[model samples]
Target: MEILKVKHLRKTYHTKKHEILAVEDFSFNLKQGEFVAIVGPSGCGKSTILSILCGLDKPSSGTIEINNNLKFGYMLQGDNLFEWRTIYKNCLIGLELENKLTKENLDYVNHLLDTYGLKDFKKAYPNNLSGGMRQRVSLIRTLATKPDILFLDEPFSALDYQTRLAVSDDVYKIIKKEKKSAIMVTHDLSEAISMADRVIVMSPRPSTIKNIYEIKLTGKSTPIQNRKAKEFADYYDKIWKDIDYHV
Candidate 1:
């Protein structure tokens, strides 16, 4: 089932002297359990479109149709976990701020921690965990509110290359295990090809969809394992050329 639809999306930045067009005519549909990754030139407004979809920013001209039953959760680049707060408390912060920290919601958060290998570290601070572990906790925190779809913007960019690979695998497993859909904006072609069902490639500054590839691997598993798929490099090369051509 289609869960979200965006059409004719465009954003413009107005300066005192002139106007700058960032994105134009971006359109796509997100399925109920699909994972979509978007890649483009650095300043092509890839993140801008994500911001509009997740309600952090408004599109100057567009239509976003979200299923009434779906809710959104956004995870930014780094872990951003609070150092002073315990891991459990960090997860509950969202529910607390929204005044939805009921017994049921609290129990749900606890269940996520226990299910995702963070049971022993509930009381531990963010600084006490490895970079990969912290990213896992950050994901649980995002899941705490029970969002139906996640909007990720360069989610693993802050981690070291090794940690980034491990964290991507961790995050992919978590999202699949929870049966959630996601739309992510990432610059890494390999990451996008390995983790997404469809990869959207956009043009420069006045961003628009150049192409969309449906990633199909011989045998799909975790993100790391998916990297070894027979068809992986082919998809990567095509996507790389598409974006490279635009650049």
Candidate 2:
């Protein structure tokens, strides 16, 4: 099932003296329960695409069809959790805003917290948790809304290398376990290769899809493990060369 479809997507920023096109003729369809990663160079309008999809910004010309009857949840580069809110409260923020904070929803959030090793820290403040834990809380908050699609924009870039790998695995597992679909914009080729079912490489601004690689592998492995898979280096080399071609 196709959850979302984009046709001839374009984003043009109009300014006093110039109009800059960020993305042009970007079109794709995302299937249900699929994880798709988009990679591009800096200033290639990665965030612009996400913003337009989320209705935070309007595209110059395009059509986005969301076939699902669920809201879209966005996770930015930072954790985006309110520092003053406790972990549990942070998770409830979405529910509160949507006026859907019922006991059932709160219980579901609690279940996620407990299942994810955050049970004991529910009452703790965000400042008390590690970077990864904070990110988990942020994801829980996004999931609390029960979105049909998740938009993640480099949510792990702020973490250290070791922490990023661990958190990437955790997040990948959590999303799969929950059976949620996601579209992520990332510059990390390894991260994109490890997390996405398909990785779409884009050209510089105005960004356009240059190539899309379907990652094929055997067995479930950690991102680090996936990186070391026999076929992993082949993908890395191929994607590297592809992106380099655009550069």
TM-score of each: 0.97, 0.96
Screening candidate 1 with a backbone cut-off below 3 angstroms (N, C-alpha, C), the clashing residue pairs are none
The lDDT of each candidate is: 0.92, 0.89
Clash pairs, model 2 backbone: none
**Which stretches of candidate 1 lie above 4 Å from their native place?**
245-247
lDDT top scorer:
1
**Candidate 2 Cα deviation (angstroms), residue 1:** 1.3
Q: Per-residue CA lDDT of candidate 1, range 1-247, in tens? A: 9999999999999999989899988999999999999998899999899999999999999899999968899998888899999999999888988899899999999999998898999999998999888988889989999999999999998899999998898899889889999999998999999999999999998889999999989888888999999999899888888888542
List, residue by residue over 1-247, the lDDT tens digit for candidate 2: 8889899999889899999988987899999999999998888888999888877988889899888565799999989889888999999998999999999999999999999989999999999999999999999999998987899999999899899998999999999999999999998999999889999888889889989999996764667778877777788888888777453
Give candidate 2's total backbone clashes. 0
Cα lDDT for residue 80, model 2? 87
